[model samples]
Target chain A: MPIVTVASPKGGAGKSTASIILATELAHAGAEVTILDCDPNRSISIWADRGTLPPRINVRSDVGESEIVKTLKQQDADGRVVIVDLEGVASRLVSRAISQADLVLTPMRATTLDATIGVRALALIEEEEEALGRAIRHAVVFTMTRAIKSKQHTAIEKSLRGQGVDIITPPLMERAAFSALFEFGGDLRTMPVQGKMEPAAENASAFAQAVYNRLVGKGL
Target chain B: MSDKPTFSIDLDSLKTRRKDTTPESQGRVDAAGEQHGFVNREPNRKRGRQPSPRVGQVHAKVMPNVADEIADEAKRRGVQQGVIIEEAWVLYKNR
Candidate 1:
């Protein structure tokens, strides 16, 4: 019944992508999962509307700040693991969710553009720590990092480590299958795949498992 | 064994209330001049009468510093802010 939030202030950080992948994987593993699609764009909402979700997985769309806390508590009370996909900005709602979170997942792409905005998102978590007088558990998942690490990616990783932020390993490599989830309107396990689908699926699963491990403190 | 929580915003009453009240009014004064057939019924008081000592939610405002203090204490005690606030309110009343 952990509440994990996928958040980043920067758009194109793969926040929605990572959220959907992790949620679907957890559901495939038989966990009852509910996704709060808090993004204004309603990415998960649109995806959910496109097809039937796997049993035990539900999507709650258009969750505003007023409704977030009660809705989250209500969802958790029903024995479902709750995942909040936050809007790509630092705001009161983001802080509120972070304060109540069991774990906060911040997605960061391997680029200078994402690095700066990504740091701000992580800082929002720190702000919640100040507000609550406790360390809010959180980590950064480097999204779209190429296997051949660019100089920018290495630099970004080193910078984050200096700030003592934990990064989920096996950085989510860029994959067509991930986007295909949105394009095809289904979970990773159910989507029809082409040549790149196998490795893409593996990456998505490993990324999800890594996130789950971090959430439970089973892995770094 | 459980499903999502539904709303307390009942939409069923719209239809039933219309049905229950419409015939009562129409039965009293029919177009055919039928005026004394049915006993006069009091239009139903608000159905789904809210339980007394009513529990409801409210949005409130306080100083940001005060809110932060409450949140910090809530975390320190591993309690919800609502619970802490409720106890503090009672203690304040006695004080």
Candidate 2:
């Protein structure tokens, strides 16, 4: 199985949102998926508690760093896709997750601070590659983007590209539906299937699909 | 695979030793022209077999000096040379 780790050092960068969207989308696509929630906030755990996650999307919360590695190894040995929702800070466990991930997705807001914080995460990834003797395919996807006044977004995009970071297409717009997702404890894909309609529901689904395509298409 | 000898052959010392071994060594024109293929000293026999069709036995062009390139970049980046070297090796291995 290929492990996809969603991580970022800056808080409120929508790491959990991206993780949940990708997990729910993949599970809906008939893949055996499991999420290892390493965030102490347990945002994903709360979402799972509210019965938002589908039965196919199995989530294991409060897992330590070593346990996450063992579980990922087991899943890889069994040929299952494992998506890890890492905490929004740099920690040993988060480092281990990035080290083990076949692909690392670092979601960033369009602010300069958020984009700057991604540099630290990228440097950490480089450090992990040095220690582990392997390269993990990573990309930065812009989240909560504003349609107009996108100068900050463009600047961040240019900076990341100059640093040789892959920026995935179809930026996730800042929609009330995304923040509203937490209240219902469900992702975009789950909301539509569960008969709850929102204006940005389809947009969220499309964004999630783009993430899936990039990850799965590269065989990561 | 047979174990390759692990002798540390310093080129600078070898050049100094060559100067002591030969009267005309102080004016050494070129190291490559003199040393390369000098061990198999039959010039006429070697010339005839230079382009021999022995695919596996034929030596390919040597790879560039990757370590030196990495060290230069590491110096410019103000980090350890090993960091650049290791990152390149990891990228190559992963690819």
TM-score, one value per model: 0.67, 0.63
Per-residue alpha-carbon lDDT of model 2 for B24-54, expressed as tens digits? Answer: 3211211211222111121233445565363
Best by TM-score: 1
Candidate 1 structure quality by residue, lDDT tens digits, A112-153: 888887777676666545545566688998987777999988
Go through the candidates in order and give each one's DockQ.
0.01, 0.01
> Any runs in candidate 2 off by more than 4 Å, and if so which?
A77-79, A189-199, A218-220, B1-95
Query: Worst 10-residue stretch by lDDT in candidate 1 chain A?
Result: A72-81
Model 1: fnat (fraction of native contacts):
0.00
lDDT, candidate 1, at A92: 48
What lDDT tens digits, residue by residue, belong to model 2 across residues A39-143?
A: 878888877886556756788888765475566665553334578887766555666566667778999999999988766777766755554556767888788
* Clashing residue pairs in candidate 1 (N, C-alpha, C atoms within 3 angstroms): none
How much lDDT does each candidate structure score? 0.69, 0.64
